[model samples]
Target chain A: MLNRIRCLLIKELTQIRRDPRLFGILIMAPIIQLVVMGFATNTDIREIALAIRDNDRSFHSREYIRALAASGYFRVAALPGPVAGDARQLVAGRAGLVLVIPPGFGRQLVRRAPATVQALVDGADSNFGMQGVNYLNQATRLFSARFAREVAVDARLRGLALPAVAAETRVWYNPELTSRYYMVPALMGVLLLVTTMLVSSMALVKEREEGTMEQLIVTPLRPMEIILGKLLPFVVIGFAEVTLALPLMRLIFGVPLRGSVLLLYALSGVFLLTTLGLGLFVSTLVRTQQQAMLIAAFFVMMPFILLSGFIFPVENMPPAFQVVAQFIPLKYYLTIIRGIFLKGVGWHALWRDGLILLAWGVGILSLAALKFHKRLD
Target chain B: MLARAGLAPALPLVTPAPRVWFNPELESARFLVPGLIGMLLMISSVVATALSIVREKERETIEQLMVSPLRSEELVLGKTLPYLLIGLATMALILLLGWQLFGVVVRGSWLLLGLATVLFLFAGLGLGVLISALTRSQQVAFQVAIIASLLPAIILSGLIFPIRNMPLPIQGLSLLVAPRYFIEILRGVILKDTAFVELWPNFAALLALGAAYNLLAAHKMKQGL
Candidate 1:
C-alpha cells in the first residue's frame, strides 16, 4: 500500500512539475498578493482631511487648532469662511472631518465652563468616522489636561484636582495599532485557502476531464490509495507555500512570529487537511474542471473569505451570521494565527482552536475519502 | 470595550455632538449596494464570458469556429454578445433588488448610470475574453478570472477600504483596476446624486479601459489563431 501511494505521489508530482505555468502561479501569486495587500490593509485612521471653522479667533482657539494638527491624525485645512455651508461643502467634497469651534470657545475653557465644539463627520464610511471621533476625543483630553495644569499654576491653586476626569488609552499588543501587523498574518490564511483549494479542487476533475481516470482505475491502487496519492502532492504544495510565505511575513512585512514555529506548522498541517478535503470533495461532485473551479470559488472560497473575520469583524456581523461563521475553518485559523502572531500565546491558550481544527480536518478528510471511494465504485 | 470602560467615567466632562453628512442615518446598504452592483456585473460578465470561450476550446469547437470565415473580431463579438446581454440583465436585476430590499434609490441620472454600467460590463467582458484566450485550460482560465476580478473589486476598489487611506503606491495601483472607477460612478449616481459634469473623468477612464481591454483581447485572438 505504501509503495502504491508513493508511486501515485511520484506521478502526481511529475505531472505538476510538467505544468510549469501553473506551478509558477501557485508559488508567485501568494507572495505578490501578500506584499500588495500588506500595504493596502490599513485600519489605523491617520491624516484625515480636517476642515476647521475657527469662529473664536482667540489665542486658545489657535492653540487648539495647532494641537489638533500636531496630533498627526488630522490635516487641518482651514475653510475660506466659518459658515456651516463651507464646512458642509468640504465634508461633501473630500474632507472626512469638519470641526466648528463655536463663538466664545476660549473664554469658556478659561473659566472652566463647559464648551461645545461641533464635529461634522462624513459618515459614509462609518469605521473611519468612529475612529476619527475617538482620536479627536483623545487629543482633546490631552489638551485639556495641559490647560488644567497651567490654570492651577497661574491661579495659585496647587492642591485642587481638576473638575474634568481624563481618560488615558494604552493600546496593548499592537501599540502603534498598525493594521498591517494584524492583516498580514490573516493574508497568509487567505492565500493558503485560495491556492490550495484551487489546486486540489482541480486535481481529480482534471484527471477525469482528460480521460485518465480509466487508466488510473486499471492500476493496482485501491480507491483510498488513489485519493491519498492525488491529495498528497497538493498538501506538499500547500506546505511549500506556507514556507515561502512565513519568511515574507517575518522579513518583508516585519511581522513577528513569537509562537513556536513547530506549533504553527502543526496547525497549518491541520488547516491544509481541511482546505484540501474541501477541494477534493468539490472535485468528486463535478465532471469538468470548470464546474469544480466555479463551485469551489462561489460555494467554498467566497463564504470562507467573507465570514473568516479577515475584512469584517465577526462580532459586528448580525447574530445569525455570526453563528454561521463558526462553521468556517478559516474563522478558527484566523483566531490561531492572530493569537500566535500578535499576542504570542502558546498552545495553552489556543489548544481549543487547535482541537476544533483537528476535528474538522479529520471529519472533512474522511468524508472526502468516502465520497471519492463511492464515486470509484 | 476597554475604551468604553475607560470613557464611562469621563462621559460628563465633554459631550461630543456628531452629525453624519450625506448619509445622515449611516445606512450600510446605501454604501454596500452600489459596490455590490459593480461586483455582480464584474463576476457575471468576466467569468461567464471567459468560461464560455474556454469551454469551446476545451470541447474542440473553437478550432472549427476559427476555420470558419468569421473574422476574429466577429468571432470575439459573437461569443461575448450573449454574456454582455446577460451582464446587463444581471445589473438591472441587482439594481432593482437593491432598490426594493435596501431602499437604495438612484438619485443621479439613470442615463449616466446605464452608460457607466455598459462601459463597466464591456471592460469586464473584454478582460474575461482576454483571460480565456491567454490560457488553454478551463481550470486555469477560471482561477485567473476569479483571482483577477474578485479580489480587486472587493479590496482595491474602495468598496471595503477608503482608497485615500491606502499607501500612496497602492493608491496609484488602484487606478489600473477597472472596478475602482465603476464603484465611484455607482456610489456617485446612486447615493450622492453626482451630476455628469462632475463624473466625466470616471466615464472617460472606464471608456479608455474598456477600449484597451477589448483591443488587446482582439489582438490576442488574432495572434492565437
Candidate 2:
C-alpha cells in the first residue's frame, strides 16, 4: 500500500514536471500572492488629506486646526471656504476625510454655548474609512478635552466637561495595527484550503471521469488505501506550500517567528489532514470536476474565510455564527497559526485546537472512505 | 410505521439548531465589491476558455489552425476576445449593482474604470488560455481554471486585506501575482479615484504580466502536447 502510494506520488510529480506552466502556477503563484497581499493590507491609514473650512477666525478655531494637525491624523489642505457641501467634494475625491468646524467665533466657548464639529467621511471603503473616522473623532475629542480642562475654573465649562477618565487603548498583539500583522497568518489557513481542496477534488473527479475509479474498485487496495493514496500527495503539497510560505513570512514579511517551529509544524500537519479529509468528502459528493470545484470553492472556501476570525474577530460575530465557526478546521488552524506567530504560544495554548483538528481529520476521512467502499460494492 | 414516518423530519433534529442569519449591508460592502469583480473575472474566463478549447478539440481543427498562415498571437487574441468582452460586460453589471443596490459610487472617471476592467479581463482570459493549453481534457482544464481564477485572486489580492500586513516575503511575492496588481488598479481607479500617474505602475505590471503569460501560452500551443 505504501509502495502504491509512492508510485502514485511519482506519477503526479511526473505530470507536474511535464507541464512547466502548471508547475509554475502551483509553486510560484503563492509566493507572488504573498508579496502582493503584504503590501496592500495596511490598516494603519496615513496621509489623510483633510480640508478644514474654518468659519470662525477666532483663536479657538485656529486652536482646533492646530490640534488636528498636531494629532498626526490629517494633512490640512487649503480651503476656499468652510461649508458642509465643500467638504463633500474632498471626500468624493478620495481625500479620505473632511472636517467642517462651524462658525461660533469662539463665542460659544466664552458663553458656554454648545459647539459642534461636523465630520464628513468617505464610506466607499468602510474598513479604512471607518478607521479614519474613529481617529478623527478621537482627535477632535482630545482637543475639546484639553479646551475644557483649561476653562474648568471659569465656571462656564463646568457643565460641558468632557469625560473625566480617558479610555486608553493599548493594542496588545499588533501594536502597529498593521493589517499584514493580522492578515498574513490567517491567510495561511486560506491558502491551505485552496491548494488542498483544489488538488484532491480534481484528482478524484478526474479518476471518475476517466473510468479509472472502476478499475480501482476491482483492486484489492481497499477503499481507505485508494482515498489515502489519492489524497496524501495533496496533503504533502499543502505542507510544502505552507513551509515555503512561513519562511517567506519570517524573512520577507517581517512577521516574527517566535514559537517552537516543530509545534507549529505538528499542529499544521493535523490541520492539513482535516482540510484534506474535507476535500475528499467534497469529492465523493460531486460527480464531476466542475461540481467539485464549485462546491469546494463556494461551500468550503467561502465559509472558512467568513468564519475563520481572520478579518473580523469571532467574538464580534453573532453568538450563533461563532458557534458555527467551531465546526470549521480553518478556525482552529487560524488560532494555532496566529497564536504561534503573534503570541509565541505553545502546546499549552493550542492542545484543544490540535485535538479538534485530529478528530475532524479522522472522522471526515473515515466517513468518506466508508461511503466510497459502500458505493463500490 | 406511522410513528416512524412522523419521526423522519425529526431525525434532522438530532443536530444542534442552526445559526440565524443577520443580514448587514455594511458588512457585505467590504467584501462584496471586490468579490464581484474577482468573481466576474473567474466565471467569464473559465467558461470562455473551456468552451473554446472543447470546440477546438472536438472539431479537430486545432491541427489545421496550427498549420494556418495566421500567427499564434492572432489566434490567441481571437479566442480571448469573446471572454474579454464578456468579462467587461460582467464588470459593468457588477458596477451597476454596486451603485444601484449597494450605493458604491465610482469616485474615479468612468474611462479609467473601463480601461482597468479591460486590462484585468485580458490578464484573466490569458490565464484561462494558459490553463487550457496545459490540461489534457476540457473537464480538467475547467477545474484548474476555476482553481486559478477563484482563490488566490480573490483572497490573496489586496482587495480584502491591505497588502502591507502580509509578511515582507509574501509582500514581495505578491508583485508577480496578476490579480493583486489588477485589484489595486481597480480600487485606485474606482474607489480611490487616483489618476493615471498614480496608477501607471500597477497598469504596467498587469500589462507586463498579461504579455508574459500570453507569450508563454502561445509557445506552449506551438509545441503541442
Candidate 3:
C-alpha cells in the first residue's frame, strides 16, 4: 500500500514539475501577493485631508489648526475662498474632514463660555470617517486640556483651582496601532487559501477532464490510497508555501512569530487537511474542471476570506453572521494565527481553536474521501 | 472636581458638529450597493466570455469553426453578443434589487451610468476572451479568469478597501484596474449625484480600457486562428 501510494505521489509530482507555469503559480504567486499586499493592505488611516474654515480668525483657532496638523493625522487642504464653497471639497473627495471654527472671536474662551466648532466629514467610507472622528476627538481633548492648564496657572496666582479630568489611555499588543502588524499575519491565511485550494481542487478535476481517471482506476491502488496519494503532493506544496511565507512575514514585513515555530507548523498541518479536503470535495461534485474552479472560488474561497475576521472584526458582525462565521475553518485558523503571532500564546491559550480545526479537518476529509470513493465506483 | 471648584468650569471651547455629505446618515448600504453591482457585472461577463471559446475547444468544435468561412472578428462578436445582453440584464436586475432592498437610488445621470457599465463590461468580456485564447484547457481558463478579474476587482478597485488608504505605489497600480473606474462611476452616479463634468475623466478611462482590451483580444483571436 505504501509502495502504491509512493508511485502515485511520484507520478503527480512529475506531472506538476513538467508544467512550468503551474509550478510558477504554485511557488511565485504567493510571494508576489505577499509583497503587493504588504504595501497595499493598511487600516492605519493617516494624513486625512482636513479643510479648516476659521471663521473667527482668532489666535486660538489658528493654534487649534496648528495642533491638528501637528498630530500627524491631518493635513489642511487648500480650500476655496469662502467656507460655504470649501464644503464642496468634501463632495469632490478633495477633503475627508472639514472643520468650521465658529466666529467666537476668542471672547467666549476668555469668559469661560462654551464654544462650538462644526466638523463636516465626508462619510462615503464610514469606517475611515469614524476613525477620523475618534482621532479628532482625542486631539481636541488634548488641546483643551493644555488650554485649561494655562488658564488654571493664571487663576492660581489669584488663589483659585480649576477642575480637570485627565484620561490616560494604553493600547495593549499593538501600541502604535500599525495596521501592517495586524494585516500581515491575517494575510497568511488568505494567501494559503488561494494557492492551496486552487491547486488541490483542480487536481482531480484535471485528471477526469483529461480522460485519465479510468487509467488510474484500472490500476490496483485502492480508493483511499489514490486519495491520499493525490493529496500528499499538495500537502507538501502547501507546507512549502507556509515555510516560505512565514520567514518573509517575519523578516521582510516584520510580523513577529512569538509562539513556538513547531506548534505553528503542527497547527498548520491540521488546517491544510481541512482546506485540501474542501478542494477534493469540490472536485467530486463537479463534472468539469471549470465547474470545480468556479465553485471553489465563488463558494469556498469567497466566504472563507470574508467571514475569517481577517479584515472586519467578527464581533462587529450581526448575530446571524457571527453564527455562520463559526462554521468557517479559516475563522478558527485566523484566531490561532493572530493569537500565536501577536499575543505569543501557546497551545494552552489556543487549544480550543486547535481542537476545532482538528474536528473540521477530520469531518471534511472523511466526507471528501467517501464522496470520491462513491464517484469512483 | 472641576464642577465643584469655584473657578469657572472649563467647558468644551469648540464642539465638533459633523455633517456627512453625499450620504447624510452614513449608510454603508449606499456605498456597498453600487460597488456590488460592479462586482456582479464583472464576474458574470468575465466567466461567460471565458467559457464561450474554451467550451468549443474542449468539445472539439473549433476545428469545424476553423474550416468554415467565419472570420475571427465575427466569431468573437458572435460569442460576446449573448453575454453582453446577459450583462445588461444582470446590471438592470441588480440595480432594481439595490433600490428595493437597500434604498439605493441612482441620483445622477442614468445615461452616463449605462454607458459606463457597457464599457466596463466590454473590457471585462474582452479580458475573458483574451484568457480563453491564451489557455489550452477550461480549468486554466477558469482559474485565470477568476484570478485576473475577481482579485483585482476586490482589492484594487476600492470595493471594500479605500484606495486612498493604500500605499502610494499600490494606489498608482490601481489606475490600470478597470473596476476602479467603474466603481467610481457607480458611486458617483448612485450616491454623490456627480455630474458628467465631474465624471468625464472616469468615462474616458473606461472607454480607453474597453478599446484596449477588445483590440488586444481581437488581435489574439486572429493569431490563434
DockQ, 0 to 1 scale, candidate 1:
0.32
Query: How much lDDT does candidate 2 score?
Result: 0.68
- Tens-digit lDDT string for candidate 1 (A148-251): 65664544453433344546677676633457888899988998999888888888888898899989988999877988898887888888988888888888
Arrange candidates by lDDT, descending.
1, 3, 2
The global C-alpha lDDT for each of the candidates, from Candidate 1 onward, is 0.80, 0.68, 0.80
Candidate 1 contains a number of clashing pairs equal to: 0
Q: Residue A154 error for model 3, in Å?
A: 3.4
- Candidate 3 local lDDT, A295-315, one digit each (tens): 887788877877779777899
Q: Model 2: per-residue lDDT, tens digit, A119-161?
A: 5565555665566666777776777667555545443233333
| Best prediction by DockQ | 3
| Two-way DockQ contest, 2 vs 3, winner | 3
Residue clash pairs of candidate 3: A117-B15, A163-B2
True contacts kept of 2: 0.08
TM-scores for the candidates: 0.87, 0.70, 0.90
Kindly provide the TM-score of model 1 when superposed on the true structure, using C-alpha atoms: 0.87
TM-score of 3: 0.90
Candidate 3 segments whose C-alpha is farther than 4 A from its true place: A58-60, A81-84, A104-113, A168-178, B1-12, B24-30, B51-63, B67-73, B96-105
Span of ten consecutive residues with least summed lDDT in model 2 chain B = B11-20
Query: Which candidate has the top score in TM-score?
Result: 3
The local distance difference test score of model 3 is 0.80
